[model samples]
Target: MAEKASESSNSISLNTVDGKIFKVSPTIANQMQTIQSLIKAYDSSRVISLPHVNAFHLSKIIEYLEGKSATTVSAVKEFEAQFMKDLSLKQLKGLLIAVGYLKVNELLELMPKTVAKLIENKSVEFLRKFFGIVNDFTPSEEAKIREEIAWAFDGVDED
Candidate 1:
């Protein structure tokens, strides 16, 4: 029991691309596939470096991993709702990529689904802004594209 408690208390250091270091328990770190693989490959005492993940995304991913194992279904649902509500589209996209790379399946599924909900009933302009995608089409080309997908523009939110 003491060994189990100590194991739970044991922390691993994660080094992000922005030179930020975060210490998390082995339990939380194991949620990320990349980190799990690294832990297996190297000594747990070593600080794992994630060159592609930024601090913001890493922290959020850690937050999700730490929160996801709640005993109650309602608590997890509430936490997940707030977590999704708190992130902006840009943050969501960044997190999606980071989670995808980390292979955090729950977060990988959640972020994209949240993004899809945000995009649902939104305009082309809204999508372009949300995704940081450039609208390079000529007026006529855009018109044709819109015409082809007229249903997408219907029932869109004004905001």
Candidate 2:
């Protein structure tokens, strides 16, 4: 019991699926809604196990939380730009799901903005390919959606 209690005190230990433990500061842990809520209401004698988050994803989440926590608000905009720059589209997509699960507001905000920027001038094929989202709609339906946002298709290299 003491061991368990100690585990939850200084750090909310996350048991990742890869059989790894991620020990993060309570403050950093709180940046993740799942962890924050767990620590807030837990008995402090149980590990806040995250069976779904594998070690790799957990590591990235923790890194983001720690970096965001340490940065000043004034510098966060710059840091946000650089942070998104470092991730590939695949990593960004994975991070999007992870950060959304954790409900990290800053990450949530930054990620969508980055995705929006990427798609703002992208071709239909480019957007679909980038997100791996199939154009499931029938041709008519697809054309409707596109026409609704017709301004988006204004400029492209397919000319």
Q: Residue 32 lDDT in model 2?
A: 78
* Tens-place lDDT digits, model 2, residues 55-95: 66777776666676678999877777787898887888777
Go through the candidates in order and give each one's C-alpha lDDT.
Answer: 0.81, 0.73
Best by TM-score: 1
Residue 22 displacement in candidate 1 (angstroms) = 1.5
Per-residue lDDT for 50-143 in model 1, tens only?
Answer: 9989988988887777777754777988899999999877788888788989899888778778888777878778888777799899999989
* Clash count (model 1, backbone only): 0
Task: Give candidate 2's whole-model lDDT.
Answer: 0.73
Off by over 4 Å in 2: 1-8, 132-134, 144-152, 157-159
* Residue pairs with backbone overlap in model 2: none
**How large is the C-alpha RMSD of every model relative to the true structure?**
4.5, 4.7
